[model samples]
Target: MRSVIIATENLGKFREIKTLLADEFDVFHSLRDFEEKVPVDEDSMLYIENAMKKARKVGDRFGMYAIADDSGLEVEALGGRPGVRSSRYGRSDDERIERLLSELEGVPWEKREAVFRAYLAFYLPEKQRCYVFYGELKGIIGFERKGVGGFGFDPVFYVPEWNRYLAEMTLEEKNVLSHRGRAIRAFKDFHNVRFFRNPTVHRL
Candidate 1:
């Protein structure tokens, strides 16, 4: 099987990506399988830049194909704040949730609209080419946190049309509407149509 390195330390993300690409490539997490701790400075102002930097860093180091994703929640009321800093929005996850909740306090539910944005970067060292895929999920923020399934802002992100928090939905349900899932699906389709034609190269 051909191997691909997924540049991320988040276990939930790793699991999702592994499941998404299982049939097509052998996926390995940098932190778990390789014990790599090199931090890719995400100082880039844009999501694409950050994702590409991580993917390129891993691909260059291992001389293998690499994939990286940078995602975050963008609250319309907050002027897209806590975007790139989604993970570290506050001291801890709880703190982050608190901060978000506080920010939305007194705001109307309709004005509390938000969207999750994901940018996926793929790097092919041998080909010296980089590709990017993006996805967005639109939903409104709930008055209180709900569910306990997903990590990050899942509990606080509510889809009124679905009448449930993101964390409350099953993986299958989330995969169809979540930003990360949509990005992965687009990436897979791109790979299948654009890069997977040649069987000479092994996939990982």
Candidate 2:
């Protein structure tokens, strides 16, 4: 049975990716699965670069395939102030939302345009090769946080098309409309083509 590591410590992110890739691999793992956890610094300016860094490190440590994702919220009004540092905006999710709202204080709703961007990186340790997939969801910042569904910025991310907050949507609904979901789907499609066509390639 083929096994792959998700290369993340975030429970919410691990759950979402694992749910989407449940049938893709025989065994799944996260950083918490091993005692000697691989340390990866997400210091890259680009999302893909940061994701690749994590995937490569974990894949090397575990001697298997590893998938990692780097995502952030980019606010147009703030000129993407927290694009790469979304996770570090504050100590907790609530604090992050508070900081974001505070930064956008007095900003009109129309100018509160923002987009959630995700980049998933798949790495093969033996081959030292990496593949990247990208996905994005555009929305505006809400006046206040709402719902208790998703983690991170979901509570305040207002989707005009859906006329609701991202946190208001169910898991299935968010999976179909989320940035990370789209990226993982794209990765799955690529894996199907590349691995199936070249069966021996995945054995590495």
Candidate 3:
């Protein structure tokens, strides 16, 4: 049976990945599913570094293929701040949102442009090599939080084309427009082509 580990403990991200890749694998797991956890230090300055670090660490620890992703919210007004440190921006999601809003206080809508970026790294334990995929979404930072869906900065991410906050969209809708979703989908497509041609690469 083909199985792979998702190198993340975030439930929201896990669910999104699972929803997209469930049919592709025989077994799927997140970091929380493991009894003995592998501690990973995500202190990389780049998103690809962090993602590959997690995938390599977890894949090597368990002797299986692993996929990891790192995503961030970069505000133009803040000079792309909170880029790789989006998760550490605050003690919690609310605090991060508050801090972001506070920093942009009194800033007009035109200057509130922001972008969400995601990088996904896949580790092939047998080959000891990692491949990365990238995706990004452009949007503006709303003055106030809107909607009740999505996790981390989604509420304040205003999609000018859609004219709705990310949080306002359903899972299906969000998946179609999210940065992580785009990256993961590209990763899936790459896997389909690679693994399909080299069937034994992952089955081993």
Candidate 1 ranges with C-alpha deviation above 4 Å: 195-204
lDDT of 1 by residue, 72-122 (tens): 999999999789888879877778989999998999987999999999888
TM-score leaderboard ranking: 2, 3, 1
Query: Which sections of candidate 2 miss by over 4 Å?
Result: 195-204
The sequence of per-residue lDDT tens digits that candidate 3 reaches over residues 80-165 is 99899999999988999999999999999999999999988888899888888888899999999999998999999999999999
lDDT of each model, Cα atoms only?
A: 0.82, 0.87, 0.87
Return whichever of 1 and 3 wins on TM-score.
3
The alpha-carbon lDDT assigned to residue 169 of candidate 1 equals 90
| Cand. 1 TM to true fold | 0.90
Residue-wise C-alpha lDDT for candidate 2, range 1-204, written one tens digit per residue: 989999988889999998899888889998888899688889989887899889888999889999999999999999997999999999999899999999999999999999999998888888888888888899999999899899999999999889999999998889998999988888877765654222121111
Candidate 2: clashing residue pairs, number = 0
How many times do residue backbones clash in model 3? 0
Q: What are the root-mean-square deviations of the candidates from the true structure over C-alphas? A: 4.5, 4.2, 4.3
Residue pairs with backbone atoms closer than 3 Å in model 3 (clashes): none
Clashes of each: 7, 0, 0
